[model samples]
Target: MAGGMRNLDPVIAVDGCAVGGEFQGKARPEGKTWLEGKRWEAGALRFCANLSRCSGGRRLSSATNALAATSRNFRQATRLLGLDSKLEKSLLIPFREIKVECTIPKDDGTLASFVGFRVQHDNSRGPMKGGIRYHPEVDPDEVNALAQLMTWKTAVAAVPYGGAKGGIGCSPAPDMGTNSQTMAWILDEYSKFHGHSPAVVTGKPIDLGGSLGRDAATGRGVMYATEALLAEHGKSISGSTFVIQGFGNVGSWAAQLIHEKVAR
Candidate 1:
């Protein structure tokens, strides 16, 4: 098996081991066969079982993994900063966790319900700011991770707002019975607690006081960031060519801004 694997592509051998553990079954070097006689299905099952065990005996969800990674990074960062242990613990914890059931009347005169979550991770620097994503995979753990990310990101960028994230386990598609209406619902419910505050949320419809530039804020920020870096090196945005991904909110705006700079 060892001799046969040596003949196989190194990448494939490494991938096989990563997925099925180290090869134990012998292979025929004459045929250049690797793991040919091994019960791959059984090995894969055993690998999954071990993976579950490592993740607290439950199937690892994306949200759980995301939160774990964020927490790990936060710990490492705090250690390097020589932060106070108590403060570090406090910073790692969320300020609030809100879960609500949103029931809306369907077009057919029936009621449909969905679960929503809002996790305010921290407010040490300023008011919390984040987006409310509407997706079926939205969960508390993922929202918490995003919120924590916002906290750190704002601080790093010197933004006056803190970090937060909210979402509902509902489709964002209109055909799926949810759309901007979902965001409106979230805003109303949140305002019931925080009062009528447009600043409390973003990515809202312009009619609801969402800035016309809201969708472009992220892209504009990226452009400005690039400009700053280039300026420090005695370069400028007008002299640069950029490759941006996605035609969506941030990417589109960044491209527009960069194009304008280049054209000028």
Candidate 2:
């Protein structure tokens, strides 16, 4: 023998790789590989072992590493492309942030307080345009991020629109009948500052002077795009199986259009 076998604890090896601290009595040797007998830190090996367990041993470790590498590559690419720090800082600024508190009477005849936020990110091109989402998670940071995205999206689309996003943080699921009332309250509150400029925001109810076709514009656009693509491929919208994922205005309209085509 080259050297006497040092009496030490048996290590726990997973997939021919030593995972962590040694396995003691009652631990049997499973198998062996050339990679064995290599020293590894207990913490690092434990982390790797936990990752393997979490991933169900389906080689997700490689995917995790790939994502890390991809992030590094993205950083390098940004540097290579000469990303403008000044432009990034300027774009990060929010044009305005509005916070309001309102009192609404509950079913119990008690007044409840609600806080709402509206963040206008930019208005370089024209009037600001965006949606007013109603969710409990609505916050200034989220509104700001979405408004910034809208600004960039409008710029990319070459639309004569700036960006604005607003919302009232409240639960919309509790009372379906009260949704319109809530929206009305939100509209009223918003109008105090923005005025009754229907064009400033889309998706307002018809009574609020919102554009007639604006509600289904996105769905109509999607349908048109799909029809053009199918026509190019010698296919028609009729007699086609359609699956819609969302139940929102756009998805609902798209489904209705497709269903009518299929019915005919």
Candidate 3:
């Protein structure tokens, strides 16, 4: 079979003799015997040769499948180890939803209509805790999901709080200078149903009986947590640098506290 392969078709011979179905054509010098019978099949020879020269000549399909399977396996393992199916299922319970529509007089002597919603989900632990974002896209489903997350978050933190979220579907952008007034109006409307319970929703202005330091509470909490983490390794936040992404209330407060207490 020494010269028997000499006259055989190069494609078939290469496929038959090559290990792992890979054929290396460039190792041979130009005009060599192996190149003599090599015929191009619509550039198939070049494609296979280029692939063989690659670090690993494995097909993209096999590599992709392998990566996907690995990721799936890792996710499964994490879920099995980290998640409690029964607890998660129990947490997913029916929630109470409130929807309101009202008209507020704008600065231009025009009345603008606004829609608002509040979702109270899972008060098993204590008072609910979540933010009341003011956005035009606010809806019942989004509020409910946020409330549910707050429930989980407060529980995980072992805080004495349940989960509730509320929002008004109005653009609080600068274009709506009347938005601040609308907020007060919405707060009043919500209080009619919730019975003037400022505890029901946080982040209210000080005039609305919001806690004196409540505005900065979240940021201070983050600073405390970061300090705790650093202290765990016998380190302090004296020279540690942090990059904050958001400039909202929480982010601003965190940055302020870090700069004053930790970074300084």
lDDT preference between candidates 1 and 2, better one: 1
C-alpha lDDT of residue 25 in model 2: 19
Summarize candidate 2's per-residue lDDT along 128-151 as a digit string, tens digits: 776665667566765675576677
Which residue pairs collide in model 2, if any?
A: 10-23
In the range 1-264, model 3's lDDT, one tens digit per residue, is 000000000111221122212243333344232332453222111112133233323233433342244334435654887867675556565357789999989999999999987777877897665656567766676667666666767877899988877777866655422222334555677689877755443445668754568657756776776666556545566776554544455556777988886564
What lDDT would each prediction earn against the true structure? 0.59, 0.52, 0.53
lDDT of 1: 0.59
RMSD of each: 14.5, 18.9, 21.8
- Full-model lDDT, candidate 3: 0.53
Q: Which candidate order results from sorting by TM-score in descending order? A: 1, 2, 3
Clashes of 3: 0
- Top candidate (TM-score): 1
TM-score, prediction 1: 0.61
Q: What's the residue-level lDDT of 21 in candidate 1?
A: 16
